[model samples]
Target: MVKKRIAKILSFRYTMMAAILILLAGGLVLLPKYQESEGIPAEQLLSNIISLERYVSTDQISDKLISQDPSFILIDVRSEERYNSYTLPNAINIPLKKLLDKEFESYLNQDQYDVVFFSDDNFYADQAWAICNRLEYKNLHVLKGGINKWFTTIINPKKPNENMSSKAFELYTTRKAASLFYGVVYPDQTKTKSVIKKAPRKIITVKKKKKMPVEGGC
Candidate 1:
């Protein structure tokens, strides 16, 4: 009878232990969700988790170019060969492998520019982003969807959906209308208004003729 009573107590202890473990496991899973629900937006939380300086979408980049925002510096993180084939105009080519090199140290440390990174895929770009973040370089951002997304979205934007809001549809329509009107959908190649240089005036020094009255007297 004593052995049976001891067995019951042991079983109860094991059950309690299991319940405690299950609760811990559940808390572990729900902690993130609960934190998300409490206050901060998920994007901000993710940025903090990844230690990103900022996040930018392809459309935002496109619009920035269209608006001629001069503070942006676009960097292509693809291979040299891939960059040579084609890249966004004015984008400097710095391959992912060489981003950490001393030669690129200045490029990565710029405080005046909003550096945007892109690659054929997000993999290399994200790697570069992480490297820069680890180095504590501020004003860095990743071009969402990378080059592929750039091709699909900014280069050739598609209608979102049939049920998209009228305002959204009108915005898209305006974009299309502007494209047709300007004959240039992308501002990567748009030349800024040029300042005309004025020619310098030529200064002619005329030597005055000395009076010849003294020579005539001689």
Candidate 2:
């Protein structure tokens, strides 16, 4: 009888422990859902919690550059050879390998410039941005689509979008109109022709003056 009683007690203890463990496992699964349901937007919550910065698009940057905004310092994070071959105008060539060096800290720490990083692709820029972010440097941004998008947007501007703002459309139209009037659009042909056609010269004859003697008699 005592043996049976002890057996019953052991079974009851095991059942209780199993129930507690199951409840804990169930809570673990439901906790995330519960937190998500508490009116917090997922992305915003994550962003607020993390130390990382966000990405900025090339078109947006091109617009800012066209507007002559001096808010950001553009950094080309490509290899020396690639950087030399081609890069955005006004961008400093500071390859990714040298990003973390102490010699660069002065330029990186300048509060006036929001350091904008770019490369042929995003990988190099992303690495540089990550390094800066880890170092707790503020006002760092990664150029979305990097140099590839820069060429697409700045060098080869596309048609104005239907959803473009009135100001943006006006700016696009103004640029187009200015290109026609200023001959900047068809530069090679128009500018060359204008340079080739010389205006008629006006030659004026000057009267010869009497030569003056030097003060020190030669």
Candidate 3:
């Protein structure tokens, strides 16, 4: 009888211990690793930036333009002067400082256009990305290498060396076709526009290291 009573007590203790363990596990899982105090946390931003999905390449943008992809929405985040000097066809100007304008909320917050942001050197576009990301906006992207890359590759494409791989030749050909379609003559080196390139996956400059780390339709 004593042994039976002891066994019952032992079983009850084991059950209680198991319940406690499960509750602890659940609490830890529910806990947020880092709080999003103001803007997006560095961890989340770093992860998203590293993921190349957040960036669109010049080739991709060009193809979309040639196809007359109405779903694509290009936003030039440079000054009005630069935007006026030369901007993508059908692109809208939205300076970085004015990104949070209430009027733009619908364009950004809506799900219709595949919004792509570009600036001279990816600086302003990245800032815009961070803002839109904080707001949990969807279908937003930064133009990789921005307009500088577009000019170098599509505007006035340099001929690849004979020794270069066929892929290089093919890419240049595609760029040539895109230039013609866009009505841009090659070798327009005098032209300049605010642009940005997608950041490299990692930036190992001394104490910090960001590991290298987007989607589309129509």
Tell me, by lDDT, which candidate is best.
3
Off by over 4 Å in 1: 1-53, 160-162, 174-218
Q: Which stretches of candidate 2 lie over 4 Å from their true place?
A: 1-53, 158-218
Off by over 4 Å in 3: 1-42, 186-218
- In order, the Cα lDDT scores of the candidates are 0.73, 0.71, 0.84
RMSD per prediction, one decimal?
14.2, 12.0, 22.7
TM-score of 2: 0.52
Error of 3 at 98 (Å): 0.4
The residue pairs that clash in candidate 1, if any, are: none
**What is the clash count of model 3?**
13
Q: What is the per-residue lDDT of model 1 for residues 1-218, given as tens digits with 9 covering 90 to 100?
A: 99999998997997899999999999888667655444345565467647544557776776787778899899999999999987876799999888988998788787998899998867788878877866668778888778887666555656769888887787676555444433445553333312222222222222222445557778
